[model samples]
Target: MTRPVGYYVHHQGAGHWQRAVAVARALETLGRPCTLMGTLAGLDTAAAPGPVLDLPDDRLDAGFDGRDGAAERPECLHYAPLGHPGIRARMGRIAAWAAQHDPALMIVDVSAEVALLARLLSVPSLVVRLSGTRTDRPHLEAFRAASRLLAPFPEALDGGAVPDWVRAKTLYGGFLGTAPATAATDEDGRIVVVFGRGGEGGALGPLVQAAAAVPGRDWHVLGPVSGTGAIPANLHLHGWVAEVRPHLASAALVVGGAGDGLVTAVAALGRRFLCLPEPRAYAEQEAKADALERLGAAIVHRGWPDAPAWPGLVARGLALDPGIVRSLAEPDALARTAAAIEAMCREAG
Candidate 1:
């Protein structure tokens, strides 16, 4: 039986881990053994039976405040990449861990360096990436050296910079999570606002002010409303919930910072969205927003938070087309990704 070891890169969110878990489940259904690797926020191992190889806490993307990514984006890049010294320090230990499992294939969710190591050992590997962002240059170089690169979302949706070979392996897919999504739309008057993990702390204040300005509608927010004072009379605040999709599905529309999770989870549900992208942040998020806006999948807003369209934008969002997400989330998406990986391995020979 073929054995695959899945590696996920974690920083501020559990996206990589979530996607990897989905892909691993698909592999299992095909009668292939998969072991999960990496460390991420709230990644509880109790949910699955695979042996876990925890990665070190590498805070690579926690760059600066979410509001000032424009001023800090350059500096964020200059900082050590996530796969730097920490990974090297632990490789020997990682190698020993690999020895115990003797995995034949390594399925990585996002790390490019794991490609380098997999290469050194002549082990086959596959990469899983978010929908909107293009493949990283370092990762593309790594992908060329690997057995296959499987994209979970449509190549037409994003991944613009990816080379043809890797693109050939792209298999756009639906979410892996099996839990039924619970959208809150029946509460017709409510407006839902989602802020990503990094969007906490200082950014919440400005967003709270913005939400306050638009109180003509009932407001609900998820993830971070701390220090913004008692939840505003118009807003309902809840801590992070495992099922965020239903909230988007049930809402009139969505407002949030540009992040992988929102792009896949919410956009897949066909909600109209507005991206409050971090100012000086990763090009990927900004670029993803750019693509989405061009495709009319969502709206992109940055700069003085009080732009004239703020209210009208909210109005238009409330009028977004419904039931579009079902097409984006075609059933059997994860199954297709797993099948593609096995096909890539056969081709590599």
Candidate 2:
């Protein structure tokens, strides 16, 4: 009997779950069963291709404040708080599922502790590699523990920063997401400002100022915006839309953070991107922005540019070659990722 594959998705951001769903669908096409495991709160579990294992939330809350101080936690672990029932229950549930299913492989996208747990359980695991400087003890140990590393980006995005061994172990699956079926005509002088839920989005004041600076252009904001002053006539706020692709498709220039989902969508749509990478753990977005700028795929600004700088930045972004951005997307990325997972499952069996 062919054993099912288990995928542990991180609930922090939408990108992880989106990638998992895409990969799971591809796996279904390959006649391989997959089970998604994660905290189901706020996620669309119905989109999952196979069985869903909703794990207990392990994050620190007022009732379950078990987080350790920075200096007190183990060097090999990123977050292992003590006396958290949720964490304990979450791990126990995972272990129980693993024992019951005896899955051929465990795909972690991604958690160091869970990867280590898979190793302890004698299960072959594939860890989804994200873009960033992940040489810390915890990340390195998890990488070592993983049977293989799956990079959901083109290898060129690595920028040759990682060690030779890590590159060798990783299979670059390319960017995984659906591109727009048909290119929507770009709305001339329309600048779309996008934000992902993973990080604190762009400040409303800066955005308004930026929009006011370019009075001729129509500015549209997607996702949450904090801080409110006076709303500009040219600036429009559409908080957290269900479909960003349509808005992105119509953009003369896409301005957003360097998260995978936004980047993937922008790249696939061949949109001229102005990247304003938000602060994130391990400088993930910063590193991604660096890679994108280096690759000539985006016009990256370190922070929200001053009001006077917006006009020049907007011109630069609009002038970027769309083909260069499109090159970052692999049309067959989802299929390729699924194939890689299938191969890993076969090897494990």
**Model 2, 178-204: lDDT tens per residue?**
556557575676899988877767689
What RMSD value applies to candidate 2?
2.0
> Which candidate should be chosen as best, given lDDT against the real structure?
2
Worst 10 residues of 1 by lDDT: 68-77
Work out the TM-score per prediction. Answer: 0.80, 0.94
- Model 1: residues with Cα > 4 Å off, grouped in runs: 58-85, 129-137, 174-179, 183-187, 201-204, 279-282, 307-309, 323-326, 342-349
The lDDT per prediction is 0.61, 0.87
User: Candidate 2 clashing pairs?
Assistant: none
For model 1 the local lDDT of residue 50 reads 64
Error of 1 at 222 (Å): 0.5
Q: What's the lDDT for residue 94 in model 2?
A: 92
| Model 1 lDDT per residue over 216-239, tens place | 777787876556565567767776
